[model samples]
Target: MRFCSRWVVRDQWHEVCLYEDYFLYRTRAADSTAPPEEHRVENGDIADIGVDREGPLWGITLTVTSGESRTVPCPATIAAPLLLRWHDRD
Candidate 1:
């Protein structure tokens, strides 16, 4: 699943995606003059996952074992299932 937010004033788009085995985050700005920044983290390397409610969107934060952290915006439907599934594996 994927979700995006736009920063109009900065002309930037921020996005996050969760796949079966990885998480992806991306951002694009300035009319794509430069390449969009992307980050990927494997499921096995994720140390922790968390959620916070902000209206209808959930802020899903992933912390990696190597110390990088990212917060991805997602809906409740995707957030809860991901949390459950990840913990179940461990």
Candidate 2:
């Protein structure tokens, strides 16, 4: 699956997409003029995948082995599939 998103306000809009073995997400807010940031982690670079949900809002938190964490807005429906595919790259 392939998906892309434009810049959105912080804590407002978030989008996460899977492109083959690559994980792409861009939801910028620090500077609206700036393009969304793209993050890619190879297999084994991931430490954990977390979900944050409140009312109707949902987000995905990715923690890498380096201890860095990034969050992207995600739909509740894709949350499970994304987690499974991310961890089970095989």
Candidate 3:
């Protein structure tokens, strides 16, 4: 499966993509030639999901089974659907 979406982190927008088994994300300035940062997580790797409020912007926190966590700012409109997709996997 493959999916891509833009997310905000530290007030900057980034492109986040999930292709096959990799969760790849990178800054817009990085461009296509730049090597993107990759994260490895299977369906069950995600252990928890939570909403984070930063003023008017909404974000999400993902806790992995290994106890590592990552936070990314996402619009409320996309949060539910995205989280639901992951939820359905487990």
Candidate 3 structure, TM-score to reference = 0.61
Candidate 2, residue 67: Cα displacement in angstroms equals 0.9
Q: What is the per-residue lDDT of model 1 for residues 20-52, given as tens digits with 9 covering 90 to 100? A: 777676777757767779888887888888899
**lDDT for each residue of candidate 3 in 7-82, tens digit (9 for 90 to 100):** 6556565665555554554554433455555555664566776778556567777678889888877777666666
Consecutive 10-residue window with the lowest summed lDDT within model 3: 22-31
Q: Please list the residue runs of candidate 1 whose C-alpha ends up more than 4 Å from where it truly belongs after superposition.
A: 1-37
Candidate No. with top TM-score:
3
TM-score, per-candidate, Cα-based:
0.56, 0.60, 0.61
Superposed Cα deviation of residue 29, candidate 2 (Å): 6.0
Better of 2 and 3 by TM-score: 3
After superposing candidate 3, which stretches have Cα over 4 Å from the reference?
A: 7-11, 17-33, 53-56
